[model samples]
Target chain A: MLVELEDVSKRYQLGNLWVDALRGINLTIERGEFLAVKGPSGSGKSTLLNILSALDHCDSGSVEIEGINLSALNEHQCSLFRRRHIGIVFQSFNLIPVLTALENVIYPLTLSGTVNAKARAEKALEAVGLEQLMSQRPTQLSGGQMQRVAIARAIVSQPNLILADEPTANLDSVTSESIMSLMKQLNREQGVTFVIATHDNYVTGLASRVITVRDGELVEDEPSPPFTLQEAIA
Target chain B: MGLGWKVALLNIMRNGRRSLITLAAIVFGCTSLIVFGGFVQSMYDGMRESMIRSQLGHIQIYANGYNQYGKAEPEKYLIPDRDLSTISQLIESESNALVVAPRLNFNGLLSDGKQSIAITGIGIDAEKEVMLSSAIRIVDGEDLFPEDIEAAHLGEGLFNALDVQVGDYLTLLASTQDGAINAVDVQVMGVISTGVKALDDRLLRVNLPLAQELLYTSDITRMVVLLDETQLTDTAISTLVSAFEQHHLDLELKSWEELAGYYHQVVGLFNGVFEFITVIVLIIVALSISNTMLMAVMERTRELGTIRAMGGTPRQVVSLILLESVFLGLIGSLLGLLMGALAAKGITYAEWMMPRPPGSTQDYPIRVFVVPDILFRTFLLGFAISLVSSLYPAVKASRLPVVKALRFT
Candidate 1:
């Protein structure tokens, strides 16, 4: 009951022609569930994640998060949603290049008038096993370590939901496996729900539930992948 | 505020060379202004001191009918009110007044029998003159001694030009009221030099009574009163003017500033030129800062988009950009003030020998005076220009759409 999308539609203006990105989609997600959104490049998976993250909007639908109807919210309210409730991780690891790991983790804390943000940032970095790497700038950290720092930044505010778009797309298989395990462990321990859009089978294989998207429509909402990471390890 | 300043400091360091170049322009403008301003102040001080010494004793008390055109035809221009001792006593009451030296002027000819030079004579009380004009007055001969009213002090230029030595009896030729030419021989006791070239060329000095007799007018011509120069400020001029007016006589009073109106006019012209040049340099500096801010806004488009996505209103974004520019101005001002102050310090040690004053023979001592207010004003003005220059870029940055800015790559 944490999120509900009722008949969402989205379109784009390409020069003079109108292209439909997503048409008539309805979906719902409950608390503490790991949902993997799967599709190919043009299947509107990224657009759905964007709308859910409040980074973009649905043209005609009600997208609800924590009982708040996002369709009724204005741009400023959408920004507040991004700041107060939703955390995002991107494929390119959008860590500010100038800041060290600790400062990057605390960057979101500065967005709001908060108390004791330094202590909270330290705790988040510690949870990500990056307490020793807090002083290292993004360029100095390895790919897996950089992704860990981005996840730490995402979790620093203790938001109710995490939306990640192609979070493992830039990593190798081994590093990708480790990032997945870290994110899963944080989600389980903290009770924060997650929605991930990905083209990688390995990432979907690790999800508890899988929704297959094709041409902007949900084709299958299955309980689990046929081959999970747990079965692969066994 | 403190955390915001830290961000500003880091960005300034990150863009090191451009900020330094901007700061250098400010420093250049401010240093030239302070140094040139110092020169003007030095000239004004030198000119004022020389005029007080050689002529225009702080105030001149003239008799009735004497002030009209040139004291023209000295025969008719005379002070009929002849209470010199009592009036001198009356002026000595004001705490700011000093040296009540009375004077009489005459037109005559100086001759050593073989050579003759037409000259103007100024008679002074050798006992009361403060020897302020020593640069022009004779140093090689006896002073304008109190007892020697019959003796004349020849100007150095005339003494050199006429080939006359001290102790030579000079014949002064004049015309009487009956239209007959009369001649008298006067002994030369001193060689006088007024630092000014024009005054030194034809001036002769004598005792007051001697000048009165030579001019054939027995009335006291005028009383020249000297004031304590340090106390003779702008406000004191009007105070003394009204006080002298209370004396109930046909007297004329003027301050030293009034005596040098032409010099002030020249200073005004220089000030006008300096201001025009300073404004041009400032405009160049301001433009350079604006260009930097524009580049900064362009570079940080993605960052601004991120901040905007995180609940930063357009007002907040504009404020951030403007704040950065204000911070830039503040930094430039700090650097400029330090460099300008150091330049001002260096200027103070330089000594210059300028041309002799206009009416005196003395070559003045010229030194730079670093006015504190001018430095402060330069810093403030530079800071303000920097802030004004950033307004356009700040607006452009704020008006950028959040989504469009994010896609700016």
Candidate 2:
């Protein structure tokens, strides 16, 4: 198993009441799995993604990624662990406004102290079909182009797992289909695990497994029909 | 530039208005310090030179026991005429020595035949006085003749009070060395201005022979030695003192610095005020820089969160913020130095005349002098203060939690 979560419980204080963001959830994800977490707004999908990526902590449970317990690591150690092993994509496409697309892609590689980071970032951008826009800043790029740069940044370091929180929420139907296909292609070819928390049906249809969440609880974890570029192009 | 510095430079340009405001504060602070320091240093130079040329030469050689008992009994402290030649010869042997003149000080009553007033008289070698007393201004008539014992120079204020003119014969009376009352009549050849009011009111100058004739004495008070450069003062003093000791002569020496107590007091006073102003300027700069960094940290919350999630260490985050502030300081200080140097040149080229200081009677042209040491110090001060100002903000930025920062609206 690449990721194993056992009896994770999390609660948040909202105004004066305790809102359970995650309650006694248990799940496991194997290597090379393309999983989509489907949920409504405020259904703990983001919270679960945060915990899985080591961006946040669980109140009570064991989160083991690649046989390493995350709770035992401090914040600094978690940061190092994430830099070396985990990649994340945000719905807002958080590319540093001051940096060019190529620089943004190289940012992860730089953090991991990768040698020849420029060549690696260039390859990643070319793989995302952004070779023409590599020198452009975020403000100069379209929403779809920005999301492509974000994805390039995520996979440039070749992390074992990529957690995307609504990676295509801001793109149109066409761009969303293209982003979903690109992510699924990376997963299939590179054997990189993906756990994406999203609400779109197009994203859900592309996943190999779909996990449904409601009221901060996991309702279903089931296998889905594999998606293909032939169907997306049609 | 590295990635961190590249982003820092971009961030500075992105917030153009805010960065410019901070830059202006730093620039203004730096420029003020350099210009003010330059002006004060020029004043010190001017005052020191004035004091040296007016009454105190680079070094004064007096007989032993003169400082302790010269005022109580002036005759007992006078150097014999033979010893005067020995001191002059020793002074000429030093390469730095320019000229040496002997002075005799006496007090008496002066009469225009209608009114009499008490006066302090100075007897000097009239030809040597012309070479040494650059600070003395001959406002009216001409300087005294080289060996004309009949000629005299009276201070402007004293001349005005006596109602005397050049060529007028004035009777000066004093007690002779034998305790007998003696008097002589002299021609007032010129009127002089010393700029100092207290000295101008009672001073009179006459040839040395006339003073000896009236007092019936061949003794001199002290020998004044001028040097080629004021910086050679300590060397000249040490050489002269050692020479006197080797020769077994009973003589003592005083440098211009020791004789001019008022100059030291003025320097001390200005130093205190300058230090206080420096503290105020630094505080203003620190607050401005600190506020700029804090606002930057606030606006970039989501950006910072994204970087942290990408595995930026806390140390890296802190370094990025500090780098931005240091860049501001370095650029701002350099600009300030340029501006200050240009302004100093303009002011100096204009030769602007400043009003006389307190107790002074003449106006002098202003000059701004910039020293290299002061320039380096000001740059370091500004840069160091800027780094200190950013310390707290950088630490706060690095300590922010990743999840909340990422979710910050």
Candidate 3:
């Protein structure tokens, strides 16, 4: 198993009211599987992704990645584990404004002390079709191009798993299609596992496997059928 | 530079206006410290040289019991002429010694035939006295010459009190060593001012031979030794002390510092004021830096979260903030030092005059000296304040929660 979650639960306090974000979630993911988590707003999709990325801890039960119990790791250890094994993509693209696209992509590789980080970053940007825009800062790049750079940064280190939260929410439909196509191509060719939390039906259609969450509970899990642009607009 | 320092530099550059304001505060603090410190140091230097040249030489050698019993029994504490010659020869042998002059102190009545006034008198070797009393200004006539045995130099105030002009004749009377009164007639050769009111009011200077004749003694009061440099005073004293010990002479030595009580009091006051100013500057600079760093952290909350999510440790985040502050400190202090040095040079070249100080009768010109030690210390202080001031903000930036920070607008 690439990832395992057993009886995981999470709660948050909002102005003296405790909201249960996740409840007793049991799930398993195999290596190289492109999985999509689908839910409505406040359905705990983000909280689940937060736990999977080790950005937050569960209130109960255990989380394991590659047989290493993430629940047993402290904050510092979790940070090291995230740096060494996991890559995260955000909804907003989160590129450092002061750095060029190439420097932003090289950031994770540098943090991991990888040798020849510049070459690796260039190769990653090339894989995402952004080699021509390597020297451009985020402000100069379009929303779709920025998301491509974020994806390049995520996969630069060749981690075991990549988690993206609402990765295509800011892009238009045409640009979203191109970004999704790029991610699908990387998954097929490089065999990097992907777990994405999003509300878009089009993203669900592109996933190899789809899981639906509602009111902090998993409601459905199954294989996804092939999706087309005409079907998405319809 | 590491990634942290690079990011810090870029962040500082990105917020150019804010950084400039922060740098201005640091610059002002550093400049104040350097200029004020330099001014105080110049005052100390001027005061020290004035005291040394006017009354106290580098060192004074006295016969045994002179400081304790000389006032009550002047004859008992007198250094005989034989001992004076021996001590002068020993002192003059040292390479650092410039002049060894013998002096006799006495008090008597001076009369210009019609009016008589009580006066304090100094009997000195005329040529050596010129070297030791270089700070004394002669307002009328010329200094006493060794060949003019019956000539005296009256203080400007004393000359006016006696209504005597230079070249006028006067009579000096004092009690001799055996309780008998003796008198001598001398010509006033010069009028001197020491910039002190009380001293100039009763001051009188005469040749050693005349003083000995009037007092009926061939013994001197003390031997004043001037050195080539004030820094060499301890070395000279050590050499003289060894010589005195070898010859078994009964004498005691006092350096200029011990004899100048007023100089020490002035130094203490200046030092206290300097320290107080330093503390005030430190607080102001620290507050300014702290506020700047805090604002930087606030503006970059999501960016910091991105870094943390990309596996940057809390320690790395803290290092980044502190690195920015250090760079700010280094550059600002250097600029301040440059500005302060230029200002000091300008003031010195302008030749500004200060009003008369307490116990002084004449105004003195102000000169600001740029001391390397003061510059170095002020730079270090500014840099240290910057680092310490950023610590709280750095730690606060590091402790920011990654989830909430990412979610921050």
DockQ of each: 0.28, 0.76, 0.63
Candidate 3's C-alpha runs over 4 A off are: A224-234, B109-119, B148-151, B154-173, B181-190, B196-198
Shares of reference contacts reproduced by the candidates, in order, are: 0.24, 0.78, 0.51
Candidate 1: interface RMSD in Å? 2.5
Error of 3 at B9 (Å): 1.1
lDDT of 3: 0.89
Instruction: List model 1 lDDT by residue over A30-83, tens digit each.
Output: 777788999888788888887887767889978998988888777667777878
- Tens-place lDDT per residue, model 3, A1-234, is 899999999999999999999999999998878899999999999999889888899999899998889888877777788887888999999999988999999987777678999999999999999999999999999999999999999999888899999999999999999999899888878989899999888888888789998989998998654333333553
True contacts kept of 2: 0.78
lDDT-based ranking: 3, 2, 1
lDDT of 2 by residue, B1-409 (tens): 6788899999999999999999998888888888888888898998898888878888988889998899888888888998888888989996478889899988999999999888889888888887678888998989888667788898888899997889999999988777788999989999888777677778889999899888899988888888899999999888888898999989888999999998899999998988999999999999999999999999999999999999998888898899999899999999888877777778878999999888776798888888677789889998998899999999999999888899888
Q: Comparing candidate 1 with candidate 2, which one achieves the higher DockQ?
A: 2
Q: What is the TM-score of chain B alone in each candidate?
A: 0.83, 0.94, 0.94
Task: Enumerate residue pairs that collide in model 1.
Answer: B136-B193, B194-B361, B195-B360, B195-B361, B195-B362, B196-B360, B196-B361
lDDT of 3 by residue, B250-311 (tens): 99888999998988999999999999999998999999999999999999999988888888
How well is each residue in A70-148 modelled by candidate 2, as lDDT tens digits?
9998988988988988999999998999999999998877766789999999999998899999999999999999999
TM-score of 3: 0.93
Candidate that would win on DockQ: 2
